[model samples]
Target: MTELSAKYGPVFSFKCGQFDVVVINQWKFIKEALANEHLLGRPKETTIPGVIEHASLIEMSGESWKQQRRVALTVLRDVGLGKSEMEDSIRDQIKSFTEVIKSSEGKPITVADKLFLSVSNNISKLVFGQTSAYDDPASLLMAKMMPEAGKMKFFNVQQFMPIIANLVIKLNLFNMTEIISHIRKFESHILDEVNIHKTKNTDDNSIKDYIDGFLHEISKRQNEKDSTFHVNTLQRNAALFYFAGSDTITTTLQWMMFYLVKYPEYQNKIREEIKQTIGLNRQPENVDRKQMPFTMAFIYETLRHSSLVPLNILRRATEDTKVGDFSIPKDSLVTFNFWSVHRDPNLWDNPELFKPERFLNEDKSKAIKPPYLIPFSGGRRVCPGESFAYLQLFLYLVSFLQQFEISAEPGKDIHLESVQNFVTRKKELPNLIFKSVD
Candidate 1:
């Protein structure tokens, strides 16, 4: 994609089946497009159970989209999204997380499973008003299938040939059966939770969590023709919250460990920063982030390095829009290639190098976040969970480093290549030996 973008220039359009896709390689073009309300609608997503018209918040657009997003953000904040309540919840998970590592007894251990459970449990609290047990069958299945689900990207052949794409989708020839089944089962689990919330029927004025809050909205707007606050929408959006919030953060924590093991110096540097700022006896808090600039820099660098979701959630033109010199027709699929923007040579010196220092200003007292360093795409449609994700990463990374020293397994290579999926992730996840720092 980088090479092709270089050849065709920053703004280029291509056809996938009957769908027109415009890829924006440069940050400037991406910024312009994201800021335009006319280009904010998400492109059609085919993997979930429902019709594309009833898209989840991540894929929904226009007034309905606006309502869903506003409701979600408001409810999340009301329930301690960026507050101390959220931090306390994460600290509890971190307690269990460290126990899992301690059980390894200083041997090499795979951390993804524990990380998934911890993160999923956090999301579960927000959406279901309760956490899924670590050993719960539904939770385990959902976590196990998420990485595989990421592989179910839009059918490449469908882009250029709409008829064939439709035929293939009809025939299930693209082999979406397994993927769809997993998603259905997961959505069903969420539905079960929503139904439970309905039965409880908590006071309309006092909502328990997102499910209860959504039910209140549903009942309040039952007469509206185009209401997006119904049960099915709740189920789908809950699944989206689980899938998007959990998997991305899980992959990121994995990448953090990978970089810490691969580059021991940065690990030590981050540890020293944590120790100096919060000390080893106490866990780090989100508030401490301001005092630990290097720790924050390391996390930012990891996001830039990994570029998970390389091609961000696809958007479509709600109306004809002009990005740069190119005219994007209404309903055209548009994507901001974050991988290209993050690695653009013009943006960073020696763009390929893993230098957290680049994020630090000359004085090294603060982190300079360039506009191009958009691990999370910007504008109104920016990741709603940005602050929550940042808190999780900050606390988890600091807690992990404070508790143990992680290193690559003896006699094994640490390959940095990533798997090509909906979210580009490390192809090889190393089980590093964890030695207690104390």
Candidate 2:
């Protein structure tokens, strides 16, 4: 994108199928575009299957989007999304996670599998009011299929050529059929959970988790006309919550380990902060973030360095709009190139260098995240899970480092080059060896 931006300027146009997509590269333009209400719609529905209007949060727009997002936000807060309960849940999962690592006995291991169970369980508590054993069939299937979910973006070839894309999906080319089958199975599992929550019928009493709250709403609005809350909607949104909640956090943790292993000095600094602030007797909590600026700085630097979701999902222009000097037609597809914004030389002193101090203030007593350092794209459409994602990243990171040190296995080198898909992840991760801190 940097190369393309250099050649075609910041605002450039490209065609994907029957759609006209305008890519905004610079922070100034990208921010302006995202904030404009006229540019808030998602791309054409045929471009993304299972994302039809009201089908899921990402696919819906206008009233349906607003109602669903509001309900989700309120229920998440009620369930202690950013509070002590959530922290306790994550910390408990962290303990289980560490045991899995201990079972490895410092032997070489691909850590993502063990880590996903921990992360997913944290989300499961919020969504289903329960957690799953790492070896559970459903849990294992989710772990196996979650990474492939990223390919949905890669398979969005329908955006450029509907006929060919339809044929590709129909013919099972590129495992499209198999992928959809897995997605359906995943959705079925979510529906089963939703059904269980429905049977409990906690509506007349108190809402328990996200699914419980959703079911309560579905029961209340079952007869209402044009109601966005329903069984199918609940199922799809539940699946979305699982997908968004688990995959991103899991990938960020994976990157956190990769960087920590590559630069042991930063890991030492983080450990020192944890020792000075929380010490070893107690588990790390979300509240400790303020006392450990350096640790937060490291996490922030990783967010910027990785730019996990490189392009912040596709958006569509609701009406004809003018961004800078360029004119964007109504219904035009739009996307922000976060990778460019994070790497722009004009935005940072040395954009390519991995220096956490860059996020710290002059005296290093406070962490300063620049407005332009937008790992989560800004505006009304900004990630609703921003706070939750932050809490998870900090607590999980501190908890892991407090107990052990992560390093590449013997004879294996850590690779930093990322595979660009739905989420930016290391092309290949060496089996990490965990050494107990004590």
Candidate 3:
């Protein structure tokens, strides 16, 4: 798509099966298209089989999307998403993660599983009001399931041609049978959790987690006409929260570790910055980010260079719309090619280089996050967990660097190449050695 954009223009339209997809590569047009109300609708046919049936927050449109988003934001805020309480929970998980690292002393360790468990536990706590043990079967199952689910090709094919894809799904072709079964298992798990939450007697004031808050909303809106609150929606929303919340953060953190080992000098710089700003005696706090400019710059650079989510989720035009003179007919699929923006030479200098100083200011004292760097995306459909993810990334990186020096295993090479997925791009795992700083 970026190659096509180079020859065709920044904004180009192409046919994918029955859908006309408009790919916006430049930031100016992406910003415009995202803000347009007509382009905010998600395509109904693009939804995968056994994945909420177009009813969850990611697929829903208009009034239903608004109501669910509002309720979710409210619930997230009330449940300590951006608060100190959430930070403490994340820190607790980081401590467990460090312990897992320590246990692998003098041996090469693959951080994916342990890291996934730590990140998943945090999301589990937010949704279920409790964290799971690292070795818990359910937690481990999800940790294994998410990356496997990402590897399925069915998700990619469905985006362009849903009718044939649905037929293929019905026929159980393309190894989708296993993926669908796993998705069903996930749905069943969420349903069980929802039922358990329902069994508990709780009121609005007693709302403890996301399920509790959502249930309270459902009860209050039951009297209203055509209310979107119900068991199915709740189940789907919880699944979305759990899957998306954990997978993206875990992938980003893995990339962070990959870069730490690939560029040991920058790792030393970040460690030194951490030592000067936040000594090893105390855990890193969210507020400490303000004082550590280079660390923050490094984080921002990782987000941009990794480009984990190269393209925003496919959005549909509800009506005819114009994005920078390109006419998008009704129901046309529109996507923002963030990969191009992040790597565009016009927008960034030496776009291929992994330079954290690009995000630093003239004096190198403060981090200057340019508007073009939209890893969490932008506009109304921007990631709601942006703040939460940032907090987790900052705290995890700081805490881990404070305790250990990460490097590739002896005779092993670290590769920055990523395996592309339907939604996210995951790094190729490499066994790492974490030498204790103590």
- Residue-level lDDT of model 1, residues 187-304, one tens digit each, is 7788788877777785445786888888888988999997878877888788888888899899899998898888999989998997788898797888898999899899989999
- Report the Cα lDDT for candidate 3: 0.84
lDDT of 2 by residue, 24-112 (tens): 99999987887799887886573344322335887777778888999998998898788887787788898888888888877888988
Q: Considering every candidate listed, which one attains the maximal lDDT?
A: 3
> In model 1, which range of ten residues has the least summed lDDT?
45-54
Instruction: Write down the RMSD of all candidates, one decimal each.
Output: 1.9, 1.8, 1.7
Q: For each candidate, what is the lDDT?
A: 0.82, 0.83, 0.84
Q: Evaluated with TM-score, which candidate comes out highest?
A: 3
Which has the better TM-score: candidate 2, or candidate 3? Answer: 3
Candidate achieving higher TM-score, 1 or 3: 3
Off by over 4 Å in 2: 50-54, 152-155, 163-165, 202-204
**What does the lDDT read for residue 437 in candidate 2?**
88
TM-scores across all candidates? Answer: 0.95, 0.96, 0.96
Which run of 10 residues does model 3 get worst, by summed lDDT?
45-54
